[model samples]
Target: MFHTESDVVFVKGLTVEAVIGVYAWERAITQPLLIDIALETDISRAAISDNVNDALNYKAVCDDVSAWCQAIKAQLLEHLAGQIADKLLAKYSCHKITLSVAKPTASSKRIRLGCRSRVMQRSSKISQL
Candidate 1:
């Protein structure tokens, strides 16, 4: 599909509060996890209808991600990001997703650090559902 644009929707700079870190001081407080996600979806119906119901509702996706992020007590950014990717992939049935999470308030110099993960919906899992 060279030069062909895929129907992709994205959510960027979605800041969510979660307890994410490996340090003792970090465990005591909530930190903001900056998230960016791009999902590959079919938006043909939405394009024709101009209806949100026919589209991939991003507000709902944000809410879902927020809820999931806030549920953690203490964790690493890598695991947290992976969990987020898994939840979104299953709920939205997207064929592919690219997710990144960054902890901006991590260091004294504010050196933002985190990980990026990409996950695909397996054919077997989709069939099972």
Candidate 2:
């Protein structure tokens, strides 16, 4: 585990279309969603080497999540957020991951309906759930 202050790699304002929500109208059509993700990692090696392989691959993560969101039908923001968190935590070498999912069309202009989830890789615990 890295005891030093960790670095953060972020993907912001990612837009994707998905089937989500409980209302009849919502279920009938695919709606646009805005997603943000921050992944914690030790960037020391990547920074020094200037190597793409040594760093957290933010593009691949974004692409994977975008594709996944488009493929699944989720009823709530929580479930969608959880699925994204689970996928990233399983696929990446991140120490911690923060994911936010927003349904722009579901809410009024004044508000946004969404959910955020954070998953951490802990040394003391083997089970993530």
Q: Pick the candidate with the highest TM-score.
A: 2
- What TM-score would candidate 2 get against the native? 0.86
- Structural RMSD, model 2: 3.5
In candidate 1 the C-alpha lDDT for residue 6 amounts to: 64
Q: Note the residue pairs that clash in candidate 1.
A: none
Residues 1-129 of candidate 1 have per-residue lDDT tens digits of 232666789999999988777788878888888999999887778888899888998999999999998885547887777778888888995778899999898767968788998888545664465
Q: Per-residue lDDT of 23-128 in model 2, one digit per residue for the tens?
A: 8888899999999999997888888889998988778998999898977788889888887887888898888999999998875776887889888853444335
Task: Report lDDT per candidate.
Answer: 0.83, 0.85
- Model 1 gets an lDDT of 0.83
Candidate 1 minimal-lDDT segment of 10 residues: 120-129
Query: By lDDT, who's the top model here?
Result: 2
